[model samples]
Target: MELLCLLLYVTVNLACIEGYKWTRQNLPVLMDQNTQLLEQSLFREQVENMNVGQFEKLCGIECQTSLPPLNQSEQERILGYETMYDNGTRTHTDVRLRGLNTTESTSYVSSLTRTKRQVFGADGRFVISDLKFITNYPFATAVRLSTGCSGVLVSSKHVLTAAHCIHDGRYYLESVKYLKVGVLHLKSKRGKRRRQRAVSKINQQNMKKRPVFRWIRVKQTRIPQGWIHSKNSTTSLAADYDYALLELKRGVKQKKFMDIGVAPRTFQPARIHFSGYDDDKSLEGTQGGEKVVYRFCSVAKESKDLMYQHCDAQPGAAGAGVYVRLREDGGKGRWRRRVIGVFSGHRWVEVGGGEQRDFNVAVRITPAKYAQICHWIHKDPTQCKTV
Candidate 1:
């Protein structure tokens, strides 16, 4: 047992020694706000045969996992690409990466100037709720991560959220082992009928008043290892992989989820919107209130992966889906709402030589990032061809 322990320590160290590094080629293509953004929709042949990125190797060689059979009974994988790897710990096939030829680096430009005052608090600004409409299209898709974080349903069986919600830089969170998603509970007709026939003094209005939810089990989770602050990793680089996907045991049939898309900072509909189960204490503790708070604001500043904004939010609001109102690709210019980023709440960064600054930011969804998320959502390259 002593010898085995020693070998295991050395093995993990070796993996750290080969600690992953980000190459410009493996990172998302950098574009300025003034540039014309080319929307991405990856084909099956392209994604399956294409090479993965540096941070994208969540269960890379170190974890030794693989593609799980879709119909497999037991769940053995949690943070890997279902298409590229298999389930369990084992040595797997390796794909050769294309040579790097760029000298570009990820830049972090700070934005302290404000377009408007940060809107938060319970004074009827942006931090508002509509419990009666929780069963609507987009609001119905909002969910609680059980671990105090918020997430938006991006597909029938997947929830897109911040990686930090489920995993720290080193390992998965203790809460993730029993992760459950809480959906707004639907009203029952039988219960309504009982209330009408109530004779006891304990009436419907006298009953307990609290937000109700229908919890669901999570089957697996996936995140880019880049999000992991490895022993030799840098925080700025790790921030690029903040977004992740959570696969639920079953799909929600009553509600429709929002679709994922690549929306640059300068997208026409400049206003950004999202909703979350904010924990900020409020004075109005009325029936079915405060469970889901909605907010929207203009983009203040943005880097390749991060976008600093004036949107007011609290700790519990992190991981909420950031979206916008825009027209579809070719739907006769029909307006549509799509997710473009994941609200990261507050984050600190190095602005210059030994100077650190903090900002309320979200992870931007670039073309490459969109492609990866698409693969995870549809699983088939064919079905996930377009964003």
Candidate 2:
């Protein structure tokens, strides 16, 4: 009778354990499927892929489409083509596709400056500058990430990178070392040396904020090696949470500090920028020891929980920050910046005996993203600013 009672108790406990596991595993799958179905229905109701002719008719540019209109110059500039020269008296410009080498598209921007005189009034000012041709710089501090890996600085004491950047547990140790931050163009300041010295001497001000750099030391890394389990390894699903935050030995100088910005309640329509050292262009076999920075812009007012951008970048530029520039008070000296997303890298799969391309995804830094990072920084809820 005693043995029979023990057996019954064990059977009941096993059943309960199996039920709990089933619930834990299937709950998220059901929720995600439901969400996907809803999104698809919404997308179908709003819009779908259409051919070129349909787009032109819908946009009311059909009459202007048949031939290269004389107004081609004006149209291109409005489409974010690089504006070359715009003297109040003259106008010149250039427009070209990125990453493509074609002489036809490489028209001089100076010519556009000459054309602007006819387009605008004599007193009209040239708002754009030469440096504007380059893409906007992003990231307060640079980080290294594995392919599709990314991280954030939640704590002043900790710098985050992808968990896969450090450890793969069963297969590999992601082999990441130190991370550097607060770098600016080495040439940006040297060009203005004369005026900078005079201004510093007159005001007795330290202008470290003049696009110089400050470096931080990554003291320790925090990640669980066992997270990449074998059963889940083939699917690569575990990498969805492929994040890690590091504990820095000390904080960078306050002047050079780049605060992680809070996400807006209703996201503003703003362009984003990102920069990173990509390994694809780096010398083979060396582990991202060289620096390679590239910048790209994101789609305006996107809806994904993860902030998505259209910039085409190579593999090495992972872990780059997607940031938006904040302009206020008519763009005075009181300028500030904030980060909105992270370059999560391309999500790819082997198809037809070769790898097929997919969209370049980045980690959206929402309010939760900022809070988690801030918590890691102070480890005290009271210290985090409500923003």
Candidate 3:
């Protein structure tokens, strides 16, 4: 009788502990861990509600350092400012680098500049000796929507791109838009070969449907963030949550759509490939509307908060996906390609300039990005892969 009573007491205690854990996971405490986040979100909404030249003094988000005073030059350059509100009045100001509040004097496009070059190689087949060294690889295409950006379908309605490519402020889909990807000509022997290989007469059907390249509009975009941009008041620019998933308007008919695979923990820098439209190229010498690919090596050093990779690109390629191949453990060490970043591009200048040789910031995509994107991918029962 005593033994039975002890067993019952132990089981009851275990159940109580499990119940407490379940409650903690599902319930919210008034002062929760996301308190800073809540504060930042409220502050951003207040700032976004302000009009040009209508900012409140000392209006800023929560941070250790005192907010900087807005200089005339800085005031006119606010892209997306974060503000503080007290008693229904505005109080602080922290500016974004692009979008919404872009001031004419302080916007990224205002400082736009680039050098155009007319690439040449051997006639017919490409010759390795004729092009720039290190920049001799092939490139793929990428695109953008209201939320974020995406990539092209290797040969079908399915497009292989980033997970954070689409966002709508919150966990909503209203901000999503159609997919628009275009391929471009590269300035290298290998780039030329890939271009020819892509457009060979034998592959005429694969020839982009339009001169601008037929864009396969997106039907749906999926993301796994329950609360995007944070419901709190503090927003960290640090690299943490990135990556998203996008679905094309139609299912790809071919079997070429494949994941880039995974990245090894110890990755190396190499000559990375990219493709995009350069408004400067057209301004200087490009013919009517020619699609082009660009190849360039990433900078040797990288910034902790900023993602960097070298590629000849420009503003129009803002949403371009940056990718690299890394060796992974698959029984033995095997080389597989994985996307590590997105072309947030040079928020401050043109792409691939001999200038600013240190950091070419790209948005780093990590495992968190993959999980968020994949959750969106397999969300709907109908869209889930059959296995």
lDDT of 2 by residue, 64-114 (tens): 122232133332232121111111111112231122212211111100000
Candidate with better lDDT, 1 vs 3: 1
**What lDDT score belongs to each candidate, Candidate 1 first?**
0.55, 0.36, 0.32
Please give, for residues 18-69, the per-residue lDDT of candidate 3 as tens digits.
Answer: 1011000111001101111113212122122112221112211112023333
Number of clashing pairs per prediction, in order: 5, 21, 42
Model 1: lowest-lDDT 10 consecutive positions: 70-79
For all predicted structures, in order, the TM-scores are 0.64, 0.43, 0.44
Model 3 global lDDT (CA atoms, 0 to 1):
0.32
**What lDDT score is found at residue 182 in candidate 3?**
37
Candidate 2 error regions (>4 Å) = 1-140, 143-157, 169-174, 177-217, 223-240, 264-268, 280-292, 300-304, 327-335, 348-357
- Model 3 per-residue lDDT at 369: 33
Cα misplacement distance, residue 365 of candidate 3 (Å) = 2.6
Cα error, candidate 3, residue 159 (Å): 4.3
